[model samples]
Target: MKDHLTVVKHPLVQHKLTMMRKHDTTTGEFRRLLREISQLLAYEVTGELPMTTRRITTPMEEMDAPVLAGRKLALVSILRAGNGLLDGMLELIPSARVGFVGLYRDEETLRPVQYYFKVPTELGERLVITVDPMLATGNSSVAAIDLLKEAGARNLRFLCLLAAPEGVARMKEAHPDVPIVTAALDERLNEKGYIVPGLGDAGDRMYGTK
Candidate 1:
């Protein structure tokens, strides 16, 4: 509910998400919707990136063109569903360095365990944006951000396709400095910790996997 967490309510983002939520949508359709949402979300995520002007040839005389001013950003994805969102965000900021954090919750303790992680160097200098499709329990997302924090990421943010109130609250309490941009924050988490009225399992929908 903080302004720091920008919940996008734009019509295009809302419409696309509605289509994606439909059970009749095909895997390709789901993938396309995710990509579209990611691209649109990228605009907000990268709104404050530093920019400077540079001389460029415009098929005529030289002209000044704006370009990114400082260190390239790090776009870390909480895999494997995060990769679905990653593809679209990358299209908007192709220069951003990529990273991945793999986390899966154990059914018994319901704790997140990391399976894989690899990030670019100099995280402290560049802005870091960690992304995932669903912020259900926030355990995995927080764990992944912990890793990024350990890697020297001071200025960080998160991008998710959807979120549950419990998940958002958890993230806010744990890492208040890290801002979040999401398409929608649903009602609440169901018994199994899934966002109610959510877009089901984003991993399954995006990749057509069960």
Candidate 2:
């Protein structure tokens, strides 16, 4: 992943994202697409994970097999919408440690207010990936990363399904050391801080809520 951002333009990812962005995509379908697309994005985000070879016997003979190195990496979901991405990622990395940081955007101020935070131990020794479906204003995402760092996470990456330029810039300015991976970088944000042409509120769409 680049130091700033990596947009996954894989054909399948783009296709699924389009399906997800459709206004009339059903709730169940939206969720399934998010899960599928998230796994694809996970493939990109975790591509450079530290690898070590271990001697293992195959059906034919012994061989050195490449495997992930160091402690099991942590997956920190940025609440509500983030859980949508988290579920799919867990299917791909079942052994990964999971954590959650609950934050909500203050409608008027567009600032993030944290209500809960819990993360894995030995955070500094493990790679941490924070997942959220949208990076709009980036207030909540940045606040979540701040909390993770305060908890001792060093190696960190931010993953999202869609990003607005404003949110990407915000994250780059606030956490330059952390890399960002997203399926798409949308045009811009609307006045309400929503990503323009974004697929509406992910949580609401996934849950059939307003």
Candidate 3:
């Protein structure tokens, strides 16, 4: 992790994202597209995971195969919307340890308020990757990462579908040690703290809620 942000520019990601942004996209289609995109994003996010050699018998003969090194990775979701990303990533890394951090904004202060938090054991020994669909204000993402750090996670990364510039800058300022990986970085956040041109409230769109 470093002061870095990776915006995935894969053609598939861009195409699916465009479909999701359309107001007419149904809940079922949106959810399906999200799952597909998450798997792709997961591929990029885990591209650099450390590898080690393991001696194994192949169809031909015994050989050393490259396997993931160290403990199982931790996949922590940032509440409801994060679960959408989590579902697809799980299909890719079924053995990953999972966790969740729940937070809501305080209307007056517009700050994150924690309602629930739980994480896997040996977090310090595992590479922790937090998932959330959108990074608008960055308050919740920063707060979630803060808690992960407090829980002893040493290696950390953030994943999202879309992010506003304000949120990216805020994350850089708050947790420069944690790198962000997103599908797209949008122009800016509107006054209501929503990412402009972002697929509207991820949770709502995914679940067909108000």
Worst 10 residues of 3 by lDDT: 1-10
How far is 26's C-alpha from truth in model 3 (Å)? 0.5
How does model 1 score by TM-score?
0.95
Clashing pairs in 1: none
Any runs in candidate 2 off by more than 4 Å, and if so which? none
Listed in order, each prediction's TM-score against the native is: 0.95, 0.98, 0.97
lDDT of 1 by residue, 89-188 (tens): 8898888899999898776766799999999999999999999989889999889989999999998999998988888988988899899899998999
Q: Global CA lDDT of candidate 2, please? A: 0.94
Off by over 4 Å in 1: none
Error of 2 at 85 (Å): 0.6
Q: Local error of candidate 2 at 65, Å?
A: 1.2
- Indicate the residue-level lDDT of 59 in model 3: 88
* Inter-residue clash pairs, candidate 3: none
Q: Which sections of candidate 3 miss by over 4 Å?
A: 1-3
